[model samples]
Target: MSEIIRFYSVTDDYGEFSNFAEYPVTLKKVRWPTSEHYFQSQKFKDKKDQQEIRKANSPMLAARMGRDRKRKLRRDWESAKVNVMREAVFAKFTQHEELRELLLSTGDAKIVEHTENDDYWGDGGDGRGKNMLGRVLMDVRQALRDDA
Candidate 1:
């Protein structure tokens, strides 16, 4: 098995792998401060709500806004969330050469978003979560490798 690389906060080792890391991505002619912002903004059906998340000063704020139940979520959001995250991750790595290089440098290592905050996107602090974000990163890494 390849080495395991776990990343959570932006201050930790492999921090660049964190969605909150300072990286900009442009998708659909709009720029987002980070992949987190892009992914979160996409949960809503309303363009105005999406715009609000896109304009948030920080990824954390964008996440908060995205989770606000008062705002209407897209009907297909639950089904489309993984693809949405994939799109954001792909855009982030492709748009930044350094970030692309960083991801590629991981080689075949198992990338994991090690956090207890969300079981779906993280490791659940006990390795029981889905780690979907990590899977997306690895998928993007493979795609980049194939393109090389």
Candidate 2:
């Protein structure tokens, strides 16, 4: 058995209706062979071919293009880390109303305390911070629920 991560890109702009009607598309697959190797073998070759074609047209343009590509890659990696942290925080806060209220009343401390159990909060090997935005959202929801 193989584990796969599915990603979908939405193209419609109808807001509610668009999301309701949107279909999930599988972007790629990770199998016995590592995704890195797969990408390096096939995807990298294809990308290199395209870059060569573009470079032939202009040398200075290609150099500038390479720099842009590197920057984009770094940005994407950082964004991914942030997203993971956000989701973790969201999940934790949504799971319990009390936690949410504590967050809204006192602040991030309540949420941070919860994340401390997880490695991502810096207590363990994970590099995530305790005061991530997602955790704060959870705290807010809990606070509202408690007042009700």
Candidate 3:
């Protein structure tokens, strides 16, 4: 098997794979700062709340805003988050040729979001977590490859 490709910070070797990387994505006719912005904004049903996250100066701030319990999270967020993230990630790669190429360059290597921050989106620093983000990325990679 090819070696696993692990990424976490925007400064990592495969940083472009990170949602926090400086890659803008447009979804639903609205331009967002990054995939992180798009994904975080989607957690809330309120347009105002979503816009606030979209306008956040950094992905980290956007993440924090998305985690704000004071804001009203969408009722379907729990069930819809994976798809939401998939959409944002797909848009990110499709919109940017360089990023798409970067993703494609990985070939069939396993992509991993290596971090302990969130078990659902990352490997939880020990490979026990779900790594949904990595799964979505690989899925998009396959879709892109199929289109090529």
Candidate 4:
């Protein structure tokens, strides 16, 4: 398919890719794995209680605080959702021609170390940040890296 795209991250590391396509790297990399509403506040944080708002400095302040909490919850939830999506992405990619071929052909050789752009999905350090995809990929890559 002309829509095929490749991920330079792996190719550049392994050098000379022979079987896979890069379309996933370009766009399909993330199927979202959730509905549009999944990212909405209703799907994440709990709704504020209006009765409690009446006790706050002002109803407006309570509303503002609620809004703030909603934002924070949304941010945290998005990070978590992507973590899940990436796992799905990783699983989906396993069936990829390139990755699958590599496993069959090489069995296990050099591991796929983190790439420049991997920071987002990567651990970003000693498990400092959330990089679920990175963690899973790293484990797979490390396994390959270690000769069996």
lDDT of each: 0.92, 0.32, 0.96, 0.37
Instruction: Please report the candidate that would top lDDT against the real structure.
Output: 3
Ranking by lDDT: 3, 1, 4, 2
The top-ranked prediction according to TM-score is 3
For residue 127, model 3's alpha carbon misses the true position, in angstroms, by: 0.6
Candidate 2, lDDT over the whole model:
0.32
CA deviation > 4 Å runs, candidate 1: none
Candidate 4, residues 45-78, lDDT tens digits: the string is: 4434322332344323543544555344544655
- Cα RMSD of all models vs. native, in order, equals 0.8, 16.8, 0.7, 14.0
Provide TM-scores for the models.
0.97, 0.26, 0.98, 0.32
Which digits, one per residue and each the tens of the lDDT, describe model 3 over residues 1-148? 4789999999999999999999999999999999999999999999999999999999999999999999999999999999999999999999999999999999899999999887999999999999999999999999999999
Q: Per-residue lDDT for 33-141 in model 2, tens only?
A: 2111221222222455333423333323433443344333333444464443343344334444553444354422222222243443232323244434334344444
Query: Candidate 2: where are CA atoms >4 Å away?
Result: 1-76, 107-148
Model 1 Cα lDDT, one tens digit per residue, 72-105: 9899998999999999999989999999999999
- Residue 145 of model 3 has an lDDT of 94
CA lDDT for candidate 3: 0.96
